[model samples]
Target: MYPISTPSHAKLLRPSALPLHDRGGGARTVALVSPALGATTFISGITEFDPGTEIPFHSHNCEESVVLFEGDAVMDIDGREYALQPLDTTFIPANVVHRFRNVSHSKPMKILWTYASPQATRTLRDNGEIRAVALEHGKQ
Candidate 1:
């Protein structure tokens, strides 16, 4: 079973502390926190998109929510496009095809995302690739 409690003392994770994955063309992702890191039942991460870079269309088996942290983005959900700004929150229902990209050529966009499950499963809509869905503590 996954641990139910956080550390006795506060746990602080800096940007450099997390593993950074390059998504090509300067786009990067960092798994900020997760049940693997003592979180109860959710996984959170930060994704940074360089100007003109975009995440391919994808969907999660579990619900996901994202908070715009900095810069602007054009979010394409299903078939609609929406503009996002700092502090804007977007909630994506499970299995909804969507994608987002930084619209500014001079600035990058950063988003903080949290998933309903500790191990969120993502399926790339175009290629059918799945990611980040490993079971934790043998929990389904």
Candidate 2:
């Protein structure tokens, strides 16, 4: 077999192919870009959020680290609120409760989330989270 650059292969994908979700609450995410590696690994693409939109308070069964690329945010984790801006990196311990909110109106929030363990994603995708019926609102 011939070899091709990873970037070349990845570029063949159209954004429309990504599975989007807004089933839970505020903000939206495209799952295909993140392409889960397993129950415990992945490099996620962009996660977009609207101004003043919050991810809602929730806890993860595993650890998560995110890098902000665009706009800014305030992360509330374990009772402390930390400001996050473009290029900022944050970490959330396993089973810890946390949330992200878009604090800018003129700019949109984008983040690169890496999961040490995608416990939630597995549940969501395996249990009809990506099913047609679960898709609400247009494309996240």
Candidate 3:
């Protein structure tokens, strides 16, 4: 972990300066704050979704909060779907199956997400594959 005791440890992150990792099906993510960046309690990042794209249903080992930043989206929690607008926020409990889908066919959607743990992990509902959340963005 990077040292946090000095002012030099502070980081200024710009999404444009980070690499976006493809999550498949037009979804991509950029991990911002994480253990790889000296964050110990939580991890955060932004995800951009192409029109009509959605991530696979998955669950996390820790609680997650997402705030919509652009375009319209649908939040799928378990088997139910909820419409979301710009600035809409959601708090999802640990182990709850959820996903975000961009509803527009010609526009993009983006969200800022934060996970409660530095060691968060995602488990795909389809094949039970697990991945470290930070690593998902190539941060570690």
Residue clash pairs of candidate 2: none
Candidate 2 lDDT, tens digit per residue, 14-52?
435655666354567655322222222543445788777
Q: Compose the digit string of candidate 1's lDDT tens values, residues 52-120.
A: 888789998888899999998989986889999899999999999998889999998999888888768
| Per-residue lDDT of model 3, residues 21-139, tens digit only | 99778989988888877788999999999999989899999999999999889999967999998999999999999998999999999999999999999999999999998888777
Structural similarity to truth (TM-score) of each candidate: 0.82, 0.64, 0.90
Q: What is the lDDT of residue 47 in candidate 3?
A: 92
TM-score of 1: 0.82
Say what the RMSD of model 1 is. 5.0
Which model scores highest in lDDT?
3
User: Judged by lDDT relative to the true structure, which candidate is superior, 1 or 3?
Assistant: 3
**lDDT value, residue 6 of candidate 2:** 68
Cand. 1 Cα-lDDT: 0.78
Q: Flag the better candidate by lDDT, 1 or 2.
A: 1
Off by over 4 Å in 1: 1-10, 133-140
When 1 and 3 are scored with TM-score, the better candidate is 3
